[model samples]
Target: MAGSAARELSFLTISFDERLVEVGSNKCRDAFRELFDHFAPRLKSFYLKGGSEEAAAEELVQETFVLIWRKAALYDPQKAAASTWIYTIARNLRIDRLRKEKAMIYKEEEFFATKLTTHETQTDVTYQNQMNTQLAQAIAKLPAPQAQVITLAFFEEATHSDIAKRLALPLGTVKSRLRLAFTRLAEMLEGSKQ
Candidate 1:
């Protein structure tokens, strides 16, 4: 009797999934409008809770629905409900944005440290000066090839194989350079305290 009840519940769930897929596939605009109308507030709250600004959260919500329109055909009714799939898309977009933001920040820091002139009198000067000195010292300590590999990996965001191809070096050589560079950097930082 319990087994029969579980089967019945599964059947109902499948039927709902199919209906949503059909709605998404055929009456796409109307289906999306309905979904957006229902879920917009929830999505805004979701993004806000996840630390996005209200304006950015609203934009992300809109982008999510736009993706739904484009990727509706890729939805698998057997795998998830419409709400779950939409939420997953929203979450993935947020994570992608965060990664890009982090990469941009790192690039900016690298650029400013290299390009900006130093004025020793400013209050902000002390920290920037220390960072610049440490970074230069670290890079200087690395062997030329190892330093090149680390710079390409961190600044260009290249994979080991990509770095290998760019430098025309073997894959193992690129990996070795990265490992040796990081080890040297750690040791340099550690020794500087004494």
Candidate 2:
């Protein structure tokens, strides 16, 4: 395995570290693909040596490559060789994966525990309904013009400019109406809590 890795590293035709640098500065996909082709199988073997199954090894290898892609800009060729940097990423990911697997507390009744928690969901739904009622009452109190703008802006998901266009009002008028409407709604909602 050691001999194979050494031969593979030596077989890279281009300056692998330089290619990594290119990937960092330029986001060159082809450079990344080249790195992937060279390092993935070797990393897979290393993961398998650590007792990961084939699927786990492949997942770890893929995760390592993803980390390498995201953190390529942090890689310094002067500080470490490309192989060393890539291996470090693979090692870290595998360690994290193993930690997560071991961290899981196996409670066979865990699913049942979640299923039994209906009161919390019921409380959430009740709170949501109360808020909705307060909101509807507050909106009903808005003057017709302000309510129109609010309806368009909130319920219809229209931007201020779109509201302005739909109402044939100036942009400043639309903004002012929205500001006034929001201010009134805030005051009403705050007063309701008291």
lDDT of 2 by residue, 1-194 (tens): 85564445344523577778888889999999988887888777777766688998898888888878888887655444566567556655655664755324332122443456443433232232333345556677789999999877643546789888989999999999899999988887556444
lDDT of 2: 0.68
Find the candidate with the highest TM-score and give its number. Answer: 2
Candidate 1 lDDT score relative to the true structure: 0.64
Best-performing candidate as measured by lDDT: 2
lDDT of each: 0.64, 0.68
Error of 1 at 96 (Å): 1.0
lDDT of candidate 1 over 39-97, digit per residue (tens): 77877877776668889989988887787777777665433455556666666676678
**Model 1 CA lDDT for position 33:** 65
User: Which parts of model 1 are misplaced by more than 4 Å?
Assistant: 1-20, 100-194
> Which pairs of residues collide in candidate 1?
none
**Candidate 2 local lDDT, residue 104:** 44
